[model samples]
Target: MGTIDQTTYTLTCPQCLQTEKKKVLDKGSNYGGSHWQEGVDFSEFDVAWAGGGTSEPVITTAVCKKCNVPPSIVSSYS
Candidate 1:
């Protein structure tokens, strides 16, 4: 096992455009290691992931707490 780090993710609600930040565990080496692993904490949000054949886990559904909507995505850093 590798060291765990913290990563901040920004999410937005598609319905009301509300934004929120969440910190999750980022595993593996950050300094050019061959292996890297990370995951999204589903307990933090009402979210779902894409299934099958993909190289990585993709966020398929994310619900916003304020708007009760399910169109949230990991926002790009500014």
Candidate 2:
């Protein structure tokens, strides 16, 4: 086991276009050669709301400081 190299990646949400800072663990970008995923994976869920729903996918991985976002935090920039 080794340490993880984490980086602050400022990304904007695709749907809401909200800017949020996400900590990404680049195992491939490690000092040595750690080829591991971000220890975490963003779960996907079907987007459906009032009236009807769109075919688009609503993935929970953004922390909108304002509003118009999912009820969750901690995610990677897709």
Candidate 3:
């Protein structure tokens, strides 16, 4: 099989209002519990593992050319 280069979005934290890039994996697998089966597919599940409760704007450091803000002053709001 050919190797594929996966791309990811470096997300920032929304709470503290800091601009930091985060690297995330593309694919992941999770095992079921007693009430659930081991081989059961968790794709249908809508569970939030981490960084789920973000209520702020995303980092604007890499803003598009259409925006008026400068890249240096741009901030990532999670």
Q: Is candidate 1 or candidate 3 better by TM-score?
A: 1
* Residue 31 local lDDT, model 3: 42
- Residue 75 lDDT, candidate 3, scale 0-100: 23
Q: Which residue pairs in model 3 clash with each other? A: 59-76
lDDT of 2: 0.38
Top-scoring candidate (lDDT):
1
Mind giving the per-residue lDDT tens digits that candidate 3 earns over 1-78? 221122233322333333433322222233421121111111212112222112222222343233322223222222
Q: Report how far residue 47 has shifted in candidate 3, in Å.
A: 8.8
Q: Which residue segments of model 1 deviate by more than 4 Å?
A: 1-8, 23-26, 29-38, 42-44, 51-54, 75-78
- In order of listing, the candidates' clash counts read 0, 0, 1
Best by TM-score: 1
lDDT string for model 2 (1-78, tens) is 353445444445455555545344434333555543322322332223221121212233444444445533333434
Candidate 3 lDDT at 23 equals: 26
When 2 and 3 are scored with lDDT, the better candidate is 2
* lDDT (C-alpha, whole model) for all candidates: 0.53, 0.38, 0.26
lDDT of 1 by residue, 5-78 (tens): 44455777667777667544434455744322334554435766553222334567678666677755663322
Minimum summed lDDT over a 10-residue window in model 2 is located at 49-58
